[model samples]
Target: MSGHLDAVLARVDAGLEQSLERLYALLRIKSISTDSAYKAECQRAADWIVGELKGIGFAAEAHATPGHPVVWAKGAAQEGPHVLFYAHYDVQPVDPLNLWRSDPFEPTLATDAHGRKIIVARGASDDKGQMMTFIEACRAWQAVTGSLPVTVSLMLEGEEESGGKNLPPFMEAHKTELGAADIALVCDTDMWNRQTPSITTMLRGMVGEEIEITCADKDLHSGMFGNAARNPNQLLAEIIASLRAPDGRVTLPGFYDDVAEVSPEIKAQWQGLGFDEAAYMAQAGLSIPAGEADRSVLEMLWARPTCEINGMIGGYTGDGFKTVIPAKASAKISFRLVSGMVPEKIRDAFRKHVEAMIPADCSVRFTSHGGAPAITVPSDGTYLQQALRGLSDEWGTPAVITGSGGSIPVAGDFKRILGLDTLLIGFAQIDDAIHSPNEKYDLDSYHRGIRSWVRILAALAV
Candidate 1:
């Protein structure tokens, strides 16, 4: 098994340029799913993926959705655990185009000051480059052994950057077909660093709300209604300010009812990861910790729930001063939830808190945006051990189990709909600048990522 795996990895190493050429071919397509003008481009990307999969002998299709088409594929049946690999082909919109060094749609390579070769493009280091790692790995295995080590399926979503509006229903509609997988693989996250590999074991959930407050029939001049008029802006500010306590704890009623403390074992593992608080703060231009005062930075980020005011609008001050008491004020608030926290319950509690704070003369309306519960995959399992062993063998370093502060809704969807646990393994670094201008993926990451997946597949075959 080791000799065969070595031969496959050697093939991956020797064919690295060909693998990159294929990835570049897909990245050159302007598959910006959010823009209507690029709908045809998205279709072209899907069609390209279908063609590639078919060439590799997989049963593949480009299925249409209301928003964008999803590319689905499956390899021949094999005597091992069935795995569903999920990734997105769609890249983010490239606004502020002038800020980019090169055309985002045109894939290019340049050496960084540190002498590392980086691939610069819109979807580089994002799902497109990441997804190719898995595909190229499968291709190498097929080229070497004539078949995949395990039964494999691919679900390449086209709407991930645009809120994935069509994915849930698509998954529900195809539940029976997708649920046959024993586990899943996701490659849309970052590694620990250039030298270290990490697997995301926990992901925080999310809930968003937009609230509008109306106090009067129309905007009022502060001169005429200086003391008499009820200012919605002032009231909204108060409501927002009252949401948190001096200790940085959310004051909403029952907000902490389901919140759980970080386990000691997990905390120990996180502490061993050498997380640099100063460096993290410097990245965001902050000097002090902003969350719960007593919690460590990692705990605050990965384990604790948080309430943030994403945006607020009320008064009028475009260019000059306008002393107008706006009749309406609105704010967008988002909550990062953790394990054991319920989404609907937290949303209801927040709404109740706001309603209770509103004055009788003022009316408040709430708009729900999105909500999802936190996801935590067990740290120890057959698939997890296999992945760990494989990754350690490939990187020559132990794979760290880490937690992600952000949410990946598809991971939770797989658990809820397909009853499959997902192993998140990727080669991108934290400085990939995904969804930002000048996004890049290290050439070494792309090369080694394919080899890592090959090792993982061989380990799983055992």
Candidate 2:
């Protein structure tokens, strides 16, 4: 097996330029899903991926959706474990276009200040570059051995940047076929650093709620109804203030009931990651850590639940003061949940907390955006252990297990609908600038990411 993998790595090294040309071809499509003008471009990008998969001997096709099309494919059946791989073809809109140094759709290579070669283009690091790494690896494997080590199925989405509302239903529609895989792989996350590879083993889930508080049926003059009529703005502000404690804990009843502590070994690993909280804060123009008083920054981010106020709106003075008590106020709030917390329970607890604070003359309404439970991959799983070793072998550095602070709805969907946990391993660095102007993917990242996947596929060939 080692000798076979060596041949695949050699094939990847020899075909590096050809692989990049393929990536450039896909990147050149203006597949911006958010903008209705680029709808055809998204379809074109999906077809391109399906064509590339066909070239690599995979049975691939582009399927229709209400939004952009999804490209689904499957390789020849193999004796190794079956794995489902996921990525997105749609890129974010290029707003403030002047900020980009070059055409967002025209991929090019440039030397960065760090003297490293980088590929500059929209969707380069966000996913086009990352997605190609996996495909190129499979291409190399097929070029060398004429077959994949694992039974591979791919779900290349076209609406990830545009909220990905169609993906869950798509997966649900193809549940048995897509869920037959023993595990899933996603190439949409980042490495811990350029040299240190990391697999995101956990992701925080979320629930969004918008609350509107109505105090009076209509606006009242402050002079005539002063101290007589209720003010929803003040009432909303007070309720928001009461949601958290001075020590940075959410005050919702039972909020902490399902929260679990990070294992000792996991906590030790995070401590060893040497994350600089001061530098993290300085990047945001802040001077202090603001989460749980007793927790480390990583712990607060990866292991704890949080209640955040996203936006608020109330009485307004367009040009000058209105001198009136507003009839209603509204705010959008979200809760970041951990492994054991249920989204519905948290929503209920929050509504209960807010309703308890309403005055006799006031009324409140709650609007649920959506919610998903947190996802955690077992640390002791065989596939995870094998992939970690494979990554370490390719990078010459031990891969670390990390956690994401944000939710990935697709991962939740996979777990919810397919009963398969996902291994999110990607080679993009933090400074890749995935969704911003001048987005790039390190040349070395692209080249070695292919090699890493080759090794992982070989290792998983049980």
Candidate 3:
């Protein structure tokens, strides 16, 4: 093992140029899944991945999906704590493209204001660059030691930017091949800070619902109806308003029934990180807390369940004002739930709340989108400890455990379908501009990321 580790490190140091070239080739594919015009580009990216994996002596293929293809690969001798590595080949659409300093598809190396060298491209840091970190690490191992420290199955989906509809079915069909993993390695999260590595301990769940309220057969003239007819717009607004109180507590009965309070130890850990609430608000051009009265800003974001009105439409929204109450009013609402809160229960409670708020003259219709429950990994897991020790050894800092406010549905799916716990470790930072204009990945991040994964693999294999 010591000799193999030495050989892998030597290979990584020698393959730096080849690694960057491969990343550049991948960045040139323009695999934007959300855009129909880029369908072929998505396939091209998948094909490229297949070639890369096969070049590394893995049996790889690009399997067709309804929208895009998923690149699947497996190394030889699949035994001994096999790991399923998950990543996405698809990148977000580069709209508002003019904001970028260079073409989003044209990868470039540049230095940032902080003197950190970075890779500028559409999917540079989001998944492509991050995924390559692990892949390149494995490549180094295979090139030097002739095999990876552990058996690995690589699954790179081309539709993560869109909903991963094809993934669940694919996993079901290939359960024997994909489900043999003892654990999953997910490279989709960020470090706590530029210098501080983070292992994401929790991820908030999500529930989305679209509600439509109808009060009349057709649009009613305000002057003609006056107070005679009911207005669905008013009813819908009132119902939404009633969901949350002025103090930011959700007003639905039993809404907090299953919510677990933040532990004092965890709270102290978060406090010690020295999060600047005022600075965070200032960046968003605000000055007041919009969450529960007693909770800190960090707690509000990472621990609390929130009711948010994603979108709403009613009456006339065109150029001219129309003095008529529309027959129907519709809204798209969502909830970010923490651990212990079931999405089904929340959806049911929301439906009940809307129904109870509706007048006899009005009718309410609810449509629920799919949802997943929150997840929290035990901090003391063996894999997590290995990750912490590896990252600390590589970066010279203690790794932090943090929770993200957003949902990563695939993480939940991995736990449900494969019964595999995922370790969320990556080198992306908070200001990487992922899913936004001018996305980038720091060059130092890309280089050190490879080294970090090397150390992690070595630790895990031990």
Best by lDDT: 2
Pairing residues by index, what is the TM-score of model 3?
A: 0.96
- Cα-based lDDT for every prediction: 0.92, 0.93, 0.88
Q: Give the TM-scores of the predictions, in the order they appear.
A: 0.98, 0.98, 0.96
lDDT (Cα, tens digit) per residue for candidate 2, span 1-462 = 557988889999999988899999999999999999999899999988888899989999999989999899999998869999999999998777999999989998999998999999999999989999999999998998899988999999999999999888899899989989999999999999988999999999999999999988988898998898888989999999999999998899999999888999998899889899899889889988886899988899998999999999998758977898999999999999999999999999999999999998789999999999999999999999999999999999899999999998899999999999999999999898878999999999999999999999989995
Worst 10 residues of 2 by lDDT: 1-10
**Deviating ranges (above 4 Å) for candidate 1:** 1-3
Candidate 3 lDDT, 200-226, residue by residue in tens: 878899999999999999999999996
Looking at model 1, residue 431 earns an lDDT score of: 82
Clashing pairs in 3: none
Off by over 4 Å in 3: 78-80
| Alpha carbon RMSD to native, model 1 | 1.1
Instruction: Estimate the lDDT of model 2.
Output: 0.93
